[model samples]
Structure formats: C-alpha cells, structure tokens
Target: NNFSKSQSNFMDTMLVFSSGTDIRNLRQISAEIESKKGALVENQYRLRKSEVELRRKMRDFNNMKDDAESDPFDVEIMEIEIQEAINSRNGARTYIEAALKTILCMKQQYDAILKNKGIEDVTEIDFENEEEEFHIKKSTQQAFEDIVASGRISVGNNRYLLQIGIMPNLVHDYWIKFLGSPNSYEKKKFDEAREALYQQLKGSAIKEANTRGLDELFYENSCVRIEHRK
Candidate 1:
C-alpha cells in the first residue's frame, strides 16, 4: 500500500508541479528544464519555513543556555530549556501540516487543469494548439521524428529540451517500474538525458533546457512540435 500510495502521490506531485513557475514568472518559455509540482515547490516552501523556525528557536535556546550557565541552578532556565524544544516542535508541526495541505491543494488544482486542458488521455499528446511544450535537441527529435512526427511535427532552432517524447503516464509508469521510485528516478533520468544531450551537443553552443507543455503542436525555429490524434 505504501509503495502504491507513494507512487501515486509521486505522479500526482509531478503533474501538480508541472503547472509551471510561480506567479512572478508566469510567462511560458521554451527553456524550462524540470517539471514542477510536489516536492519541488512544496518542499521548497517547507524548507524555508522550517529554517526560520529553527533559526529563531536556536537563537532563543542559545540565549537561555547562556543564562543557565550564569545561574547554574536557576529553575527558570530549566523551564526555558524545555519551552524552547516545545516551541521548535510546535513550529515544525505547523510547517508539516501546511506543506501537506499545500500538496493536497495542488492535487486538486492539477486535476482541474487536466480536465480543463482536455487531456483525455495523458499518454498521447500533440504539441500544436497545446500551451505546454518540452523542447529537445535534434537527436532526441530523430526518435520522435520516426514515431511521432508523421508530418505533424515542426523543428526549431536552439532546441535543447528534453521533451515528453512519450506521454506523462507512459514516462511515469516506466520510471516507477524501472527505478522503484518515481520522484528520484525521474530526476535521475532527467540527469541522464542531460549527460546524453551534452555528448550529443559537443562542439555545439550550449542551448537552454527549453520546454513548455502544450495541449497541441506548433512551430518555432528548429524546435520540433508534434500533435497527438484522438
């Protein structure tokens, strides 16, 4: 149950985080590398909040410890010492709860986005007419060109995206099956793709990791975009 639940949550997180950047950087670009959603955003916030709590607690704790050293038998020092731990624990619990809630909220949001985006089958997707796109180098395009191109794909310049040559569901399932952990494996595979890409692009100017998930396919320089059929 834990494995299945974890896998499901991992997929959910992937989709949720894939919604793109925060409000500050909302414009779609072709250079995005990682997909966003769960641990990426949620863990980041949780870390920041926890850091603040920890710093505040440590400062207060250190001050109390100093006071205790000055008055070794002070009863108030003992009380303060206990309270400091309690405060830290309380802060951590609050952050944990908030992080969990944020994930739950993202789950709801992603599901809604899928429905709204008309992603009938999360597997087969067409890049044109789709707002999101994941760009890749011309090499990755060969695999895609053979299978997905079908006269429906377009190639562009500065192409250095690790696109979803296969749909998210397929990619998601494959990672979980092979590596036994979706989150960790997906990131690992992404890294692998980078290694492969680097070798492929040797002597070539390093291009950005450009990608924007779309509901359909379209054209832009050498970037190849393909459309999925119903």
Candidate 2:
C-alpha cells in the first residue's frame, strides 16, 4: 500500500507540473495571437485607406492632364504621387497577407497543444489556481527519491514517464543527481541508459499494440512476424 501511495504521489506531482506548464504555454500563445490579430487589422485599415488615396490621386492626375493651362511640371508631379500611392498600397497588402499566414500557423499550434491537454477552450483555464496547484512543496531531493521509489520506470511506460512525467518536472539539479556526477563519462552513461529504456519501452508498446490489433493505430512502421509454433 505504501508503494502504491508513493507511485500515486509521484504521478500526481508530475501531472501537476506537466498540465500547468501546458496551460501557461497556451495562455502565452493566445496573447501573442491576439496581439498579431490587432496588428493585422491595423494593416488592413491602412491598405484600405491607401486604396482610397490612390483612387483620388488617379482622378487628380486625369483632371490635370485634361487642363490645357496646367503646367507640364505640375502634371508630372501628380503622376509621381499616383505611382507612390500604388506602391504603398501594394506593400500594405503584401504585409497583411503574410501576417494572416503567421496567425493561421499560430492558431494551428494552439489547437494542437489544446488537444494534447484534452482541453477544448482556452477560456476555461484559470491561471491563478493553476499556479497554486502546481506549486511543489517538496524539496528537489525528496522529489527525486519519490521518483526512484515510484517503481514506474519499467518497459512500455518510459514514453510517458520520461517525456511527460520526468522531463517536465526535473531540473538540472535533479538530472545531476539522477545520472551521477557531471563528466563526459557520466554523460555517456546517461545517454546509454536513456536509449536502453526507450528501446525496451518501444518494443513492449509495439507488442501490446499487436496483441490488441491496434498496431496500425499506434505505429506506422511496426513489422509483425508470424511465429510458427511447431
């Protein structure tokens, strides 16, 4: 029962950090999107205003050209003004299109992150409560010990454990403790340990998927071999 409790606590702690970090990221991205949208609207307005000015300039040039008494120099200046207006309008239009593309890409990212978090709406996020809930009360050393005791570091679960649980929650200090003293040798050891864990987990997950007939859903390149038992 104690082991189970320790595992539960470790997972809860990891989840708090993971979920809270994602929500915070979503909020930051939302703010950026709104700011960009405002700029896009301003640019659009400028483009429209430029179009009106261009039309008015063209009309002025036409009227000046028809006036026989009008100075030749003045008519030439009007033509130059109309050309400048056309350039300005074109630039504004190009900028607006590019801004629109950027916003579309950002929105796609926002949606992807939202789906990963299993949240439908950004409006539902409560930042104040999220911070309070994710605040870790335990010291780094204690948390590390809890992780070691969790017994969740086995095959088929490292994908979640490493990617979602440990990587998000652990800092440099935690890694130093985890992988041993900082040195080239230690780094090599760390890499080897990680790769070994990944291979074990991948194989396990693939086997489980095959047994459940969910291989295609989970993996695109998994090879299934028919075992002939004689």
In angstroms, the error of model 2 at 24 is: 1.5
The list of candidate 2 runs beyond 4 A from truth reads 1-20, 132-175, 178-230
lDDT per model vs. reference: 0.42, 0.56
Residues 92-132 of candidate 2: C-alpha lDDT, one tens digit per residue: 88777766665666677678778987878654325533432
Clashes of each: 37, 0
lDDT of 1 by residue, 125-206 (tens): 2333233222333333343343333422233311222333333333223323433435334656655653454344442222
- TM-scores for every candidate against the unseen true structure: 0.29, 0.52
| TM-score (C-alpha, index-matched) for candidate 1 | 0.29
Residue 130 error for model 2, in Å?
Answer: 2.9
Report the poorest 10 consecutive residues by lDDT, candidate 1. Answer: 24-33
